[model samples]
Structures are given as C-alpha cells and as structure tokens.
Target chain A: MTGAGNSALLSIRHLRKEYRPGQPVLKDISLDIDARGLTAIIGPSGTGKSTLIRCINRLVDPTAGEMLFEGRDLAKLAGAELRAARRRIGMVFQEYNLVERLSVIENVLTGRLGYVPAWRAFLRKFPAADVARAFDLIDAVGLDESFATRRADKLSGGQRQRVGIARALMQAPALILADEPTSSLDPKTSVEIMELMAKMGAERGVPIIVNIHNVELARRYASRIIGMTGGEVVYDGPPEGLADAHLKHIYGGEEFL
Target chain B: MNAAAREWTRFTPGERIARAMLYIVTAIAVVWSIRTIDIIPEFLYDAPEQTADLFRRMWPFDWAFYPKAVHSALIETFHIATLGTILAIVLALPLSFLAARNFTSNPILNLIAQFIFVSSRSVNSLIWALLFVAIFGPGALSGVLSIAFRSIGFVGKLFGEALEEAQQGPIEALTAAGAPRSMLLVKGYWPQVEPAFWSVALLRWDINIRESAVLGLVGAGGIGVALDAALNNLYWDQVGLILAVIFCVVVVTEIVTSTIRSRII
Candidate 1:
C-alpha cells in the first residue's frame, strides 16, 4: 500500500511496541510523515519517542502495526527484504556512535555497508563512486579534509555528530531519522547540529523525522511538530500551531517551560 | 537514643568466628603438609653441601656441548611455541565469536563453545603432551599440538570476553545501516576488538614459549628432551647449561612481548 495520504513518504499505522510482554512502551500510535521537510517529535524522557523512531527502522521491533514506506510493510519484512528496506532509511544516534578506533572517513563510508559486498567492506575496497559520495557528504556536513584521517575518538562531540550526520546522509536515504542528535551537545553545538541536519535533509530532498527533547530547537527548526506524552500523540501539526497549552500538556507541567 | 552510641564493627560475630576458623584450618593444613612430606633431618642437614657440590659441577657452562645438543633442541622449542600459538589462534578465533554472548546470542552455541574452552584448559599442557606423544608417536608435531590444544581455551576465553565487552553503540549504528552479519563483524566488531585480539594472541604466544620448553620431557620434541638426556646421564654441567638457556629465552621472550604489546595498543 502507498502512504496513508498519497503525498506522504512514510505512514505508520496503529504502531505499538512493548519491550515487556504486557508493558507497552509505545501505545497505539498512528501518523503520516510527508515526503519533505523536517518533522520533529517533542516528548519528555520515557515517553517512547526513541522507541517510536527505532520501530520505523525495526531496530526495536514493534509488537504490532504497520510501517508502510515505499509500498512495503517495514514491520512485516525479514532477512534480505528487511535489510534492503532499512538501507533506504538513514539513522543518527544520540551518542554519535562512530567506531572509536576508525578514521572519520572510514566511519562515514560505513553508510554504504548495506550495498557493499562483505569481502569488499572487509578489505576497505568500497566502490570508487561510493567513496566519492562519502567524501562529498562529509564535506557537506562541515568537516574539513584534515578531519577525515583523524580517529573518531579524538574529535569533539559536535565534530563526531557531524560525522554521524555525514554517515547517515551517505546512505542516499529517502528518509532520515535522528534520535536526539544533540542531547549531549552544548546549546550552540545543538543548534548547529540541528541546522546541519535540516540543511542536509533539505539539500538532499529527504524527509527527516527527528526525536528531540529541546522544545526551542523543535520550534526553530521543524516544519511540523509532533507532541507526545505518555506514549501517545498529544498534538500533530505545523510548528506555529503548537501553543503553550500543548507544551504544558506534552511535558505534563509548566514548571520547566 | 543517639543511634545506640553508633555500634559498628568490620566483621559481625558470625564472620569473626568464620575468620578464626579459617586461620585455624590454615594452620592445621600447614602442619599436616609438613608431616606428610616427611623430610629427614639427615638429608636436611646435608642439603647445603649437596647444593654447593652441584653448583661446583655445573660451573664452566658446558660451552662445547652447546652446539652438539642444546642448539638444535633450543631451535625446536622455539618452533613448537610459534607454530602452536598460530594453530591455537586459528582454532580459537571462530569459537570465541560463538562463545561471546553478545555475538552469538544462542545459548546452546555459547554453552558448546564454553564447554570446549573449559575442557582444553582443564588438561594441563604437560598432560596434553603425554597424550599427544602416544597418538602422534613423539616429535615436534606432538609438542606443537600439545601447546595449541592447551592454549585454545586461554586464547578463546580472553578474546570472547573482549568481544562481549565491545560497546553497543557502534554495533547499533552498523545494524541500523543494514550491514549483514559478516559486514557487521568486519567493520563493526573487528575494529573495536582488534587491539584486544592482538593482545590476547601475543600473551598466549608468550605463555606457549615457556610451556613448550618443558614438553620434551614426555618425548614431544623440545629442549626438555635434551634436559632429560643430560639428567639421565648425570651430566650436571650439561643440565645446568640447558636450564640457563631456558631461563634466558624466557626472559627475552618476556621483554619482546612487552615491547610489542606497548607499541601495538
């Protein structure tokens, strides 16, 4: 089936995830993500925002429901089909999970692992085109040529996240999901990272669904805002439509706001 | 009541009693061992004289005998250690992946791998040498197999632990990238665990060197065969030279491995 709305790129329907048998992390959640622009999911910790994003990629399998993208059910796929589907959807982690001992260029090139043969990957003999694309994406993410050879552990948090974004974009994805990509960063770095992600997503014409706890960043960067509380969506609309009442409801208090 | 004057002790009364019992048991064990050994006063009194005589005989180094006996035997010991370590690494590498709970996740496979490691470790290399000598009919091949079989457990166990300790974040990133199991291993797991893998291999090789030097006692070829021949013929000087050679080799290997380990990581 196509997306719930024909214009949507990913349609998640009645999705539910329970890490435990009876304790659901994500309640029956249904949302349609459009083909372009950034959609930010704003929620407090423990509200299943991370789980929801992960479920779309099947990193955390949903207990029930359908994730329809590119005319296939992501939740129903297995083996090779699942991997093929996953390669089209890029992911960025909260921790900027670059392999610590590897060089920056190598970490970024890992995005093409799904398409590269095992022997080629092992030999670090990625195809010339993929290598060129990886370098372009790295430059696009604001890392200079000098940083490419440096080991990942030597970089600052912002630099590492830049590499993380570059790696995600190297997948040539139709959709990118960033799970709290700036949680560990300073406010300035967080804003820069958000800006970078938005720029990369827009430049590539890829729809981005980001789970961010920063309400201000969400308001500033997102075209659409999805407010979640207690594993359920409290609001789904354009950024300007998200009012203080909605924030109070989503976070369960006006104390922090 | 002011917290009952803060009554506190490092050990409870029961623990104190247990500690006392442990000390008493240790004392009894020492006394029992001394009684069992049954050292004669006559021999004890003459021990120093015998040692002095032995050393006197061992002096001058047996320099002429080095080429005829010690040289070839020393070479054989080195070969056995190197070959055995290489063989163990090959055999243990795959088993380590199976044993690591994070890597395999199959409890049955993990259990099988653990069983093999435990079995290999439980049999001492000397005992393994004896067994292999019977099967392979006594040669450097038997010595090599003995060291390898005994070492598999050690190398596998440490490497498996290293694999298990790999950070989950990098693994998650690769899995999200849709890398297959093999790609994940080559790019994801291998990069993270490379230093540990090399560390374990080098450590095992160092241990194998010391162990192989003794394997020839059971007729598996190594310097111990030369030592045995010297001892049987009562060539104390020759025996002394063999012992010195072994000591020097062990010291050199220790130095080499330590230098390599420091540089690698």
Candidate 2:
C-alpha cells in the first residue's frame, strides 16, 4: 500500500509469490513506483526480479500481496478488473515477444486490444484511430514507414526490440514494465535500447519499472534502482547510492556480478 | 576411434555356422509361409503359359457398362469422402484441444482422447467399412462412416501434436494480454494452427479419395463394386480397365488437392 500521501502510481505491500509450497520465489517484497520517471529493478538470476514486475499485471499470480495500481488493489482483482488494470500497464520482454508471424504494425496495434471489442480484434479490424496511431508509433520508433507491412520475423534483433518498444508505446500506458528487455541484444545494441527506453519514458513521463541484469546500464539510465536478492528486496535507492557491497549481496559473488 | 575395434572383423567359425543355420531356417520358414498362403507358384512353373491364358481370358472390357456404372456410385463416392472429411475435421478440431497438453493438461482427458483416436485409427478403413456395412447395410453411408472414423483419428492425432510445438510466445503474450480462455482457442490458437490444419486436411483429402474407392469392396458404394463384380465373372479385362480408371481418379484428385493447397499456403 502507498503511504498516507499515496504519491505513487503503483504501490506494492508485503508481496509474496510461491510456485510451490515452502519454495518462495518472491518473499515479502514491496515497493512504490511513482509516476514520471524510470525505475530499474536489478537482481541476479533466480531472484524473482521478473516475477515482481509480472505480478502487478498478474501475469504470474502472486501467492499473497496487496498490489495497488491507480487506486485499485490489483492483487484482489480478478477477470475483467485484472484485465482492465493490465491494459494501463504496458510490458516489453527480453525476447521482444512480438508475435513473429504478425507485421510490426499489427503488433503495435495489439496494444490497443484492451480497448477494442473481441470481434474487432478477432477480425483484425482495429479502429481507424488505432491504426493511425500504430503508424505514428511505427514512425516514432525510427522504423521506415514501409516496414510496418513487414512481418516481425524478418526484422533484425535490434529492429525487433525497437518494435517491442513501439508496441509498448502504442498502449499509451501510464506505467511500463520491462523484463530483461536487453538481455538478448549485443552490449552496444543493449545501450541503444536503454537509450530508447529512457527517452520514451522521459518524453511521456511514464514510470517504467524495468527488470535488468546490466547493472552498469541500469545505473546509467535509471532514476531509481531496486535491487533484489533471494526473492527479497535488498536495496532500493538511487543508482549511485548502491555500492559494491550491495552488488555482492544481490548477486552473491564478485565473479558473476 | 580405437583402431582394433574399428577394423573389419571376420566372422568366427561358430558365428559363421550359426549364421548359416539361421539363414537356412529363415529360408525354410519363408517358403513354408508362402506355400501355406498359396502365393508360391504352380504359376511360377507354368509362368509363360499361365500368363498367356489369363490375359487371353481377360477380354475386351464391357465398355457399355461404364455409363451406367458411374451414375450414382462415383458421385456418391465423392460425396462420402467430402462429407466424411468435413465431419472429421470439425470433430477433430475440438478433440485436438482436449488432446493438446498445452491446452488441457488434464492427464485423464488427454489419455481418453488418445485411446479414442488410437482405437479408431487401429482398424483399417476396410474393417471400418465392413463393420459399418453390417450396421448401415451396403450403401454410401457405410463408406462415409468408415472414412469419417478413420479420418477423425488421424486428424486428431496429427493436429494435437501441431498444437504442442506451436510458438509459445504468442500464446504467452495472449494470456498476458488478458485474453479469455475461449478467446485463446478461437483467436490465438486457431491462427497458429491454421497452416498445419489446411495442409494436412488437403493431404487427407487426397488419401480419402483413394480410400473411398476401396470401400466399395464391402458394398460401400464406389468403383470397388465394379472392380469386384468384374473379377467375380472371370472378366480380367474389365478388372484391368477398372484399375486403370482408379489410377486416373487418384492422379486427378492428387493434382486438384495440391493446386488448392498451394493456393491456401
């Protein structure tokens, strides 16, 4: 829950996610994400960093928690309510996760799926406004205009991540959650992606909660850093404030970190 | 990579003797089985004269029978295959959902579906035709049931496997997008499975056309009746003519199916 002031756009309280009994993947983790900036969640493998971000959208159901987004408790929501909450929060994935067979533009339009009726979505009949916005998003993402007609599978990895960003942008979301969105890219490409993400988040004043492994990149781009270890929130602060001691604690060793 | 192990080794005396004895026994068994089955030859001894006798007796085909023979029988054959395929595709689509591990995941449901499909597929179309002939009694209905039963099993098994390996990314995205369960099947699942479905369905259509032709042996109506009748009367020429027609039918069906399938993909 947010503090008495409730300044955050999304609030988490006592969150726990357990895939099996007595084997908690996320244990009693909680944080508040205020609107208007980028927040990076940094953690090593198996720390439930991805699970925390996915939980707000209920992608991976939390075993127990209070996740409040926009005045509604997401953890308590179900069915339509959960979907409606999710629509406001866009997500990008490590693999880009664009429907490979679909065109880049079509994938962008998929962000509008929450707004469109099921029939419209089923028939690929997005509203004209949605289509126009999709084209605009395609243009905004630095893709060639004609590339909108190309299938996602044909794009290079960097281009696909660009499309992934565009698809998230298409949602016009107040909040964005990215799960290791750069892990698949080259180091150079990963920075370019981080730059794009930061630029987009800054331009829209949308708080993006990103789960990333690249601590240096996260330090460079993120306004706030959230480090998790062993399913617990270990360190939550500004990037410069997180020390080598914390990195060792979060990753559990110097070599891996 | 070992030199000694990789070298070509000669057989030991005992091994050679065992091999000789095994070969002798196999040859004897094969000959006995063939003789018991009446496939071994008095005809081999009189091969030249017997061939001549058969070909001569297999006379000028009764071409007058062609016009009457094709009337209801051939049309009904196509109808049976068409309707059977249609019904099987319809039935198999849902059964595939139950059978797909990603979709149902219920072990009991999956196992039951497998049992149903396997049992249906285990019997040959002729056996199905024979069984249905007993029930539906010597008509196109028997042929339809036979084809439908066999196709249901085949289409279900193949399509279920396709559903398993289909790109999980889209499915994951769809669920994350908050698509309903029914929406998952119709919108997300169907699109992914469409290409596999169309290609296989067309291939099955080709096979079913040939299966329909053979179903007539058990009085499930088609070219098989004519073929069977021609053989019963010692009309080898007419039997040969029927085989030629069947060959033509199969070739044309294959061409048509492939052309349509190419367009679909």
Candidate 3:
C-alpha cells in the first residue's frame, strides 16, 4: 500500500473555512491521515478543531479547501456525490446526538440509512441483516440488549455516547471522526469512552480522528497527536514528543502548563 | 450629594405627557364610537326586561326535539370537525416542512408556504363557510371544507415553528452519517416534532368542533342548521336545547383533548 506513493486514507490540503467574511476559522489546514490507529487533535476552545472535523463530512462547508478521501475530492462533491462520500465517514458527536425520542436500536439502525431505501426507513422496515448488525453493535459498544428498546433520552451521558459510537460504527465506515466525544462525560466516563473508541478503532482497522480539549486524555489515548493553535497546527508528533514547550506554544500560555 | 435625596419617577415628563395624551385619545375614541353606534333609547331602557322575557320563554326546553333533529345534526357536526381536522393535517404536514426555514432553507418556498397559511387564517371559518357554501352548496361538505381550510394555517404555522425549534444537533449527526434528505426528515426531524404535531392537531380539532357547530348559521350544515331553523321559527325552547347541547359537547371535547395532549406531551 505504501508503494502506491499516495497511501493516505484522507489527504486534506489548504482547507480554509470562514463563517463570516475575512474572519477565517480554519486557515489553510493541510494534513494526511493513514489508515490505522487513533489520531487525537488537541486544541483550545474556538481553535477550529470542531470546524476542521465537520468540514470533512461537509456538515460545515469550507470556504476553500481540497479534501481527498478515498478517491473523490470531498470539497467538490455535491448532492448525491456528497451524501455517498459522507456514508463512508462515521462521526461521533460531543453531545451524543442520538435522536432523543427514538429507541436506541432505531438510532443505531439510522447509521445504515444511507444504504437502506428511504421508504423502508420511513416504514421502520430495515433489512434483517442490518437489524442484526445493529443489535450486535449495541452490544459491542458496551450496552446490553436491554438498552436497544430504551429511548435515547433516558440514557445517561456515558451511555448515550456509547450509543453514539455504535451508531457511527454501524455504517461500517472507512474512517471515524469523533468531535470531542468525551467532553460531555464525567472524568472516569471520559477515559472509558476514549478507551472504547481506541479499542474499536483497532479492532475494525479504521483510523479514528478525534478532536479533544483535554491534553492528558489525548496523550494517553492517541497514537499520534496534532496540536493546533489559532487555526494552525503547532505540533504534530507522537504523544512523547508533545512536551511542555509545545504545550505552551499550542495553548499560548506558560502558566497553565 | 446625599443618596437619599436622589429622586426617581416611573416616567419622565415627556413620557407622562404622552401617557396623559393616550388616555385622553382613548376616552375620546370610546365616546366617539358610543355616539356613532345607533342605540335606541327605548330599547336600551327595556334591555333587562327583554332579556328576562327571552329567558322565561327559553326555559323547560323542547327536550322532545332531541331525538328528531338535534341528535343527528350533533353527530354530523362532530364528523365535520373530526374529518376536517384530519384533512387539514394531511394537507398542512408537507407545507409545514416547507415553511420551516431549517428544513427547506429556500426563501421562496418558505414564503409560499407562509402565504398559504396567512390566507387560510385571514378569513374566519364563518366567512370560509360562506364561500364554500357558494361553491359546494349548503351542507356538511361545505362545513368540512371551511374548517379544513381555516385550520391549515393554524396547524401549519405552529407545527412549522415546532420543526424550526427542533434541536439541530441530531440533524447534524444524521447529515454526517450520509443519510439522504428523506431519511433525515423521517428519522431525524419527525421524531423530534411528532409530539408537537399531535398536540397542534388536537388543539385545532377542538377549535374546529366549535367553529363547525356554527357553520350551519351560514347554511354550511351541522347542528347550526337546526339551531338556525329553530331561531328563524321563533322556537325559543328548541334554541335553548340546541345551545345547551353545544355547550356540553364543547366542554367534553375540551376535557378529551386536554387529557390526550397531556399524555402525548
């Protein structure tokens, strides 16, 4: 695979996003992600980490960018092409954005919505294999079968995040992007969630890219760490190379370090 | 500068003058309206006596008329309200999605949906009943059409607002998963707005029931036709019985809707 020269699963180049004119959130971001292990992106609030992740799935359109994922230019894809590309990328949210009124099983099944016919989804008549896979995924994400029938709103923060993971994995995605998946969880739950994600990524052999606020958690769980500051990546290395000097540079303060 | 010596008034001098002027204008307007409205002094003086005499004639209602006309008319009224509400729901559901800015994101479509709602709401049900009666002829069909048309605005506007108010988080997640627009609507938006949809439907149904009860006044059909006939014939006893029945049905519908709304919400 390395002999092909361009072996990156996702290659982002000159990705720029600005919500308002002249006030860019992501400034000329360029990176290549290989197809394995967990990569954690650590940055302070409002540093464009979430925006960066969102741009990959085209949830937040980039002002200007080139994101080559699989074989398509993600930035140029529109309509059906955009949707087809999105189905390959699983996304976990900070809020565990499961449909609050839907049952857990339904939420997981929604991960297969891109593949299922619209009418079947409307009638809640997902294929039997997809249903079985969803059930297995629910169990794999650390939730028992009992959780499948419960409403998502009834789950605690931790449990909800687990469902979120299962929902993402249900897509059988080529890549997984988690945008602060552990931020809403308690400290212990945060660790567990991160561990679960890392384990899941390894098991499925899918590269996981996570945007995280906690530096320690990133260092602990990430195979590769990319530190960003002011919409620019300041440090890109293994966890051991992320020293206090790099931390000060990335966060723009020495006292916090 | 003593803090205690500082003075404060609810309104400034300009505001006080403005308020005083408003009151004077309101008083003058009321007086003008009262003077403009033609009220005969003799009728005004005998109002209490006329009311008492009418009440005296209305008592011991013609209960014998219950099975003959009022019962079937009452049932027809209920049917008009229920069917009208169901039809309105069916017609307004798609329009509501279009009207919701978050859902459609097209200004022109939103404007068209909103325009339909406003036109539907601008005319009262009675006025709509008149129009429909002209088109469909005086019957329950006219009443149903009037109720459905009038209610589309109310149900569409409120349910559109509910759709707009739905959390964008789950929708974003669904979008990221590459779900098609229809899937997002059915799986994402529908679940969030389902309760509000039912609540709005029930509320509109309740109001439609009351409105349909009076469509017969315009020859559009229902219990109102029987009530109108009794009033035209000067059968005060039958009128009293019809009014009493309407009151009981309205009260019962109110209770039923509130109970269902509470459970759904």
Largest TM-score belongs to which candidate?
Answer: 1
Specify the highest-lDDT model's number.
3
Worst 10 residues of 3 chain A by lDDT: A1-10
After superposing candidate 3 on the true structure, give the runs of residues whose Cα lies further than 4 Å from its correct spot. A1-4, B1-24, B38-45
Per residue, candidate 3 scores C-alpha lDDT tens digits across A1-257 of: 22246989999989999999999998999999999989999988999999999999999899997998887889999998899999999999999999999999999999998888999999999999999999999999999999999999999999999999999999999999999999988999999999999999999998999999999999999999999989998888899999999998888888887
Model 2, which residues run further than 4 Å from truth? Answer: A1-5, A255-257, B1-75, B255-265
Model 2, range B53-170, lDDT digits (tens) per residue?
8777655655666676744566777888888899889888888889999999899999988888998899999999999999979988888888989998899999999889787766
- What TM-score fits each model? 0.97, 0.86, 0.95
Residue pairs clashing, model 1:
none
How well does candidate 1 score on lDDT at residue A94?
95
lDDT, model 1, position A156: 97
- Candidate 2 interface RMSD (Å): 2.1
Q: Write the per-residue lDDT of candidate 3 for residues B1-265, one digit (tens) a residue.
A: 6875597788989999999999999999999999999999999999999999998999999999999999999999999999999999999999999999999999999999999999999999999999999998999999999999999999999999999999999999899999999999999999999999989999999999999999999998899999999999999999999999999999999999999999987
- Kindly give the stretch of ten consecutive residues in candidate 2 chain B with the minimal lDDT sum: B171-180
RMSD of each: 1.5, 4.6, 2.3
| lDDT (Cα, tens digit) per residue for candidate 2, span A1-257 | 35547788888999999999999999998788898788999987888988888888888889997887888888888888777777788888888877776788887877776667888888888899999999988887789899999989899998999998888877778898898999999999999999999998998888898999899999999999998999998899999899999999988879864
